[model samples]
Target: MSRAEELKQQLKPGQVYRREDLTPYSNAVDRHLAQLVTEGVLDKIAQGMYYYPKQSVFGVIPPEDEVLVRSFLKDDRFLLTSPNSYNALRVGTTQLYNKRVVYNHKRHGEVDLNGKKFFFCKTPYFPKKATPEFLLVDLVNHLDSLAEDREMVLKNVIVKAKSMDSNKLKYAVRAYGHTKTKKLLDPVLVQMKSKAHVH
Candidate 1:
């Protein structure tokens, strides 16, 4: 088989690939990649990055957010989340956010990958998936950045904290919450305990 054909065969639909990832398969990787783009076999999402679009009844489908970021970072050690998701917690966060946040050990700042903007936050801590407690902490941590009433949100957070599992909430605060989040949540947790004793 030709070099281009071999490389194409190796690519999976709905997957993103960097030029370096195809190096082992061909010597003229760049040229062949351009040719594939011209042939509409591959969609060039960014410089040196390509995606094999998945076909559906509607049309071509872009790679999922996590899939794109995992391939772009070339590592799975990152947490994918949206601040808008905090709206679900009903803590007075109702505005929608355009960008998704990626908390990872490497790569800081905004990145435009495959036409989607992602904010890569370089932090030492992040969980594989966000828990309710973690999400609460995260909401408070980024409260300043959100287009909402901060003081009101804080009050709602305290109210919402009442319904959360005390042990798990404490653990989440200690493990995932930042110093400010800890400080804010401490009183709420204490209130939770005080109320518990009353009952």
Candidate 2:
């Protein structure tokens, strides 16, 4: 089988392939990949990742960013939480405000790639198990790039929280535990309840 054919068979959306994965194939693989690029059969998203261009049609076609996020995960036991989660929640929307993508790397500091920023905020007490609500909050905080829109975000968050089942909410709250996030989220929850009562 040819390199192009092999790549086609192995390709999956959201998956990254490295050069080493193609090592045993053939020397002409690079040439074939380049040809694929020319033909628009694949996109060289970053240094080593490639993906079908069609995947980007749904929204912002950030193939390179996705590749980098996946690559970062490969090196550390990290969660694509925060900004990525926010990105997921707002999929298909162009109004998102993710200036620099954030990740909970289970460490500290930040790293920049291809003119984009990635913040790796270290936390010593991240939950061992994540809940849907906690996940949602992490996403909201990460995507809430502006400090001024806290009220709007909190309102949206309350609506989202109410939509969830009580058991799930309990589990989510527990999973998230008591932290600074609650103070930020509490008013939103209260406002949502108040609105519901008024109606």
Candidate 3:
């Protein structure tokens, strides 16, 4: 078999790959990538990103978000979420957003991958999964960017904070909260503390 075929044989369906990953398979990496793309063996999802589509009985199955992002960032340590998820909290945020937010230690800013926009937020700390407490804190962190009435949402946040486990919420606020989020949640958390004293 030829070098191109050797490289092509390395591709696994439903996998997202960065250019560096295929370099080991081919010395003429770029040339082989172009050949594979031309032959429809690989789909170029974004600049320097490629996907080997998985075939289903219905048709072609797109690469999963986790797979695409893991390859794009080249790290599995990232949290994927959407602002639209805030609606699930029922804290008066009802707007639907098309944006997907990724919290990672490496990259920040927005990039389009496979026609979807992902906003990368580089943070020193983030939970492996977006817990309820984390999402609540994240909602307040990005409150200003939301389309809702900011003051009204904050009011609801205080109420929601009271309903949550004080210790867990406090931990989330301290660990994941942005500066503004810290300030916003601080007073409510303190109030919870004082109320505990009263009881």
Instruction: Write the residue-wise lDDT of candidate 3 on 15-111 in tens digits.
Output: 9989999899998999999998999989999999999999999989988888988999899999999998888889999888999999999999999
TM-score order, best first, reads: 1, 3, 2
What TM-score quantifies how close candidate 1 is to the native fold?
A: 0.94
RMSD of 1: 1.5
Query: Which prediction has more favorable lDDT, 2 or 3?
Result: 3
What CA RMSD would you report for each candidate? 1.5, 7.6, 1.5
TM-scores of the candidates are 0.94, 0.45, 0.93
User: What order do you get sorting by lDDT, best first?
Assistant: 3, 1, 2
- Count residue pairs with overlapping backbones in model 2: 0
Q: What is the lDDT of residue 181 in candidate 3?
A: 90
Task: Please provide, for model 1 over 30-84, each residue's C-alpha lDDT reduced to its tens digit, 9 standing for 90 to 100.
Answer: 9889988999999998778899999999999988998888888889999999998
Task: Tell how far residue 54 is off in model 1, in angstroms.
Answer: 0.6
For model 3, the stretches where C-alpha displacement exceeds 4 angstroms are: none
Model 2 has an lDDT value of 0.56
Show the lowest summed lDDT stretch of 10 residues, model 1. Answer: 125-134
Colliding pairs, model 2: none
